[model samples]
Target: MDVADGVLVAGYRIVRRLGSGGMGTVYLAQHPRLPRWDALKVLDDRHDSDSEFHARFLREAELAARLQHPNLVAVHDRGEDHGRLWIAMQYIDGGDLAGLIRRGPQVLTVERAVRILGDAAAGLDEIHRAGLLHRDVKPANILLTTDADGSDRVLVTDFGVAHPIEDGVKQSGGVATTLAYAAPEQFGDGPVDHRADVYALGCTLYQMLTGSVPFPRTGAGSVMYAHLHEPPPRPSAANPQVPKDFDAVIATAMAKNPADRFASCGALAAAARAALTPTPRRRATRLSVAALVIILVAAAALVGVLSRTTPSQARPVRTPVSGSVDGSQWGAFAYIAQAFPDLLPGFPYGSGYEELSGCLPQDTKYNNVPLDTSLPIGTLFCLGNRDPVIDLEIVCNADRTPIQPGVALADFPEGDEAWSRPSGSGHLFWGHTTFTDTGSDLDGHTTGVLEIFFDRADRNFCRIQVVGTPTTGADLRAAWWPGAPL
Candidate 1:
């Protein structure tokens, strides 16, 4: 088909062919009015008269459109242009994960693998939450994009083969799914649900981390048999740097029985996050410092050993400032503020106080304090006592060493230095909240903290930061307490 022969559909001008697959051919298109671009998938005319295929296609489109998540590609509009069925979706500039792996180095860092799979899990969770299963989840269906801020983001696409949970009818012969990533249930009459997606995600993650499929077989039936009976080897066996916990997570996700796997995609994502945590000792060191500092300060005040200082004695905390000050309320405001322009639009801006104005209560007593009391660990805040402002930083520490403070705010810039010196707007009264390690050897603890800041009389921000620790949840709970007096 010639690219220029078709009329513009839904105001998107088709530029050129992107790629063709079993479902349809995708075209590169641009919105006539908006600056955004899109990929338009047009089903071939051969299927137009087939009612069953059309119904299935429409159902898939409806299901995909209902899902709105960061890791899922969004469908913008669907219609017929010149008697051809077409769907417009957000255009991702980057290539598929499979292509990236096939080219050059093929191996991925443990952090990169976990992060990508975690994002895909989140997307799958959203899909399952909507009562749909991505029957065809594979590396080729997962797209990778680097935001303007340089953070890697994963987008799960091509849900044309996805099955709706409520629909009892089985899809008849025609298009075949990728065997490499297909779960065993997909090969037979076993019950399929969110667990199938989990299994496929496990296979995808395995391939991504090790640069090879879990079961490499020349025949589709052989691969399916392996998925049905064999337990995949640990990724750490291939790459020593991969954590043992990750191996357990993958094994669990790829369990032969659906009941043996995580209950949902969200659970799998949470497990992946837990497995991705670095050695416990380092995490503990990050958490310990924050906990110890808070405890010591509290203890000193409780005992007669340290006198409580009046507001006059408090000093104005100085630190660099920029972007929206309201970010402080969420614990990683500074990072989000600096990262917004590159990550997303519509960032609030003004004096730090002005940016935070809407989030603050009218009552002066709680003016600068975060509205949310029970925040995720590692949130930073700005405290002022009607006089000089104090930079209140909370961070995770293990073995007494502070992990850099600030939460990983969505749509925020990603980099170690970005957390330290965020771009744009400047004032300095900085404080970082950190977690600490509690083990005898600092190797077992995980540190996580939130950061918030009050600078001069204007700019202030809050943020949450976390570092993994080897310590248990009980110890973390015991050590976690805001330093403010009750």
Candidate 2:
């Protein structure tokens, strides 16, 4: 019978077919009584008639239901109905990793691959801890969830073919796993363990990083034999950007002999984390040099300006300026609000106000109270090269702001020239030094400081205010850096 002919089973209304796998057909169904959606995997009655397959399938579902991990798909219910076996699971809106890889290679960045693999490994580790082995881990079984915020979440699914350690199945399998990802031992005469899952994870990771499987070949039998006898190719051979350590990890996991692999999936995950850690030394060195150059330039300019002024004139003075928001900065906000209406509502001038200032070379401190938590708002304060002196200072708040205390201005690579635009803002933060003439007489200017304010529900709908001293047309052109293009 066709899937559509099936009635609503146990309050679940099958809306459409999700996909068909080796075990059964999965349907996207919703609960009639509760606000819930699920993927219903119904075993074909034909397969259930085979006692061996039915027993294995039911046992696999029971075993998987007992294993719980954030990355692993959660099973909600399992039972037999009208001669068909069915298992209900969480409905993952996003589909599997195979579709993601097929879209394009560039879509998968190194950082993304590392994160996905690390999360998947953590899931496998949990399964290993439960004394079960996911013998059929592959790209098709990994699901990717893309949230409204654009972040990606990975979910491992399809444990219907997994086996428990206590199950006394013989070395020669009744059911073999995906040929391309199956571990060498699956084809050998031995009982498989957690390492088998680790091997499959390695193959999946290899595919994610390189856009192709390590053992991709013509025939299924040929691929299965290669898993049994051939050494897996290094991922870096296909994508050199993959770190050598990652290649080593993959090689060790996919080793023909189980003794050569990591003892557990947890150990493999730790190694993946280490390989993915950003190179701190290189990033630190680059930031240090950039800070030094900025300090020297500011100091030289400060000295030249101080030379022209007397001591009386050089005495430090605080000046506060305010006006009816009518300037290029306001115009920039207006343009941004219009471009990203969803992110920045009530364009141009938002519900809050922002201010900017340039302090002379000296030590200064800012103590701000944490703005009310109920009101979601942000304020931007910028320090510009007013005196052209190499000055060391700290930007901090004793009780307010999300930025941590004791942040050195020069430590940030972009310096005061960097700005933070709210997530929903179509325009990125602009520093005082960046601007561009956008045809017409109008110019797009970057603010030295930006502040956003909004309520909790509208936190994403904050306003960006910029403050900076005007520069000559030529100087502005020289320093002009435009906001990120939409």
Candidate 3:
């Protein structure tokens, strides 16, 4: 019902209308007992006779009220007044994301898009954790507010289309999804879960980055048909300024097969954050002799200590090789340190390496770290070694394989197996292993030997590969200790 201003609905005094949609009308209302104002949502009076619509309205209130997360809108109370059901929620002064995108340059920056959608992803994860699915997740449904620090805090609002676990994706009627953001499975009768939300979030991220949906609305059923039969257009194609790494993130998130998508909303957000993170690059500068001497002395001392200690009882390195372990070029290191701090042990960042290159697809032609993983098979960070036969390369796995601690080196790369060991926290793995590539992009079936170490915690997939000179597993372990220089 269109209640006039100054009217009371369930003890909340209606001040003015905020907005209205297919679900109901939202009003800015002042609470009777509290001094704060609340957004009062009144269910449509026309649906009072329909039990299904009424139940859906109450379900939204109940589901949202139980979810208590900063990323989600808070539900205060719900009741029926004047034969109309009403739910009171926190009132946000800022407008929705849709309005922001439309008013601005029609798109948001990578940082802002990630920030807004990352928070929204957390809210979606919370909803999934509550055994509920927000079937309708669009930019218009996301409300953005400013925090005390003047930072944007986005909250996922409008749970009117939330589906409970009991529904099992079969809503009796046809797909109840927005055509632009709906997952392919939503079109046909299949089981919908948290992945459906992931698909929609991916679409939302695509819009935020490219200022347009994956598929344009060409006709009545063309967009829906494209979502079912076609692949999503790359965000970079629409906006050249969009980072290349985002292409893979969006592709995986919008994968037609739910099995191919990330396991959860949190995983998708983590991937997006990681994609936006910069990788290490080589700088045009000379290394200091004093720093080099210090690193060499530390490495020598570490080797001597390892000679005495047993493999199982090896000690953790206490001192950093240098103060500049986390350098300006070490962007991936910074990214990992931000999320998983213990994974990176302040290894001298800018001191050792002369040239850093990623193992790209065939004939990619690169002199520096690639901006995206479009053709990345792995990363190779080369150090300036005097002996041509000896290659010291840092292998960062871009294959996205999930390698865990205690796994043998033979299991990961093909070659002669030597030895492998895990760090104290089981987040990093260092192994001196040999592998033979048969017609591969990197080595081309040639038998090669290398000492490899990778971060097994997050999806950074960073690995340190030392080719030539096959040393004992224990020696490699001690030589490449966490805080020691490479």
Give candidate 2 misplaced runs (Cα > 4 Å).
147-149, 173-175, 277-486
* Model 3 per-residue lDDT tens digits across residues 1-486: 467889989888899877654367789999999999999999866688999889889888998888999999999899888789999999999978764543222235678888887899999999999999998887778999889998898999988888887778664555566666889888777688889999999988886776555775422255678888888678876655577789998999999999999898888888888878846232213557787678778979999987888443563322223122333323343332222223232332111221111112121242354323333444333332111113343333345564443443432343333333443123333334433452322232222233444344454354444443223333333223322322
Q: lDDT for every model? A: 0.55, 0.56, 0.63
Q: Total clashing residue pairs per candidate? A: 90, 15, 6
Give me the candidate number with maximum TM-score: 3
Better of 1 and 2 by TM-score: 2
TM-score of each: 0.54, 0.55, 0.57
Summarize candidate 2's per-residue lDDT along 1-486 as a digit string, tens digits.
236724686667888767655477778888667799888888854576698878877876788789777898898888777777778888899867765543323456667777777788888888878877778887778888987788778788888677776774346543367666788777766677888888888887777676566665433455667787787888767666667668777888788888899887667767776777746565456567778778779989999987888453665321111112222322322222232232221212111111011111111232232222112222322222111111112222222333321222111113222333454322222223333553311145332432223232223333333333332322221222222111
Name the lDDT of candidate 3: 0.63
Order the candidates by TM-score, highest first.
3, 2, 1
Candidate 1 TM-score to native: 0.54
Candidate 2: Cα lDDT at 94: 87
Better of 1 and 3 by lDDT: 3
**Candidate 1: tens digits of C-alpha lDDT, residues 283-336:** 457567789778768877776633455332363212222222233423433333
Q: Give the 10-residue window scoring lowest on summed lDDT in candidate 1.
A: 353-362
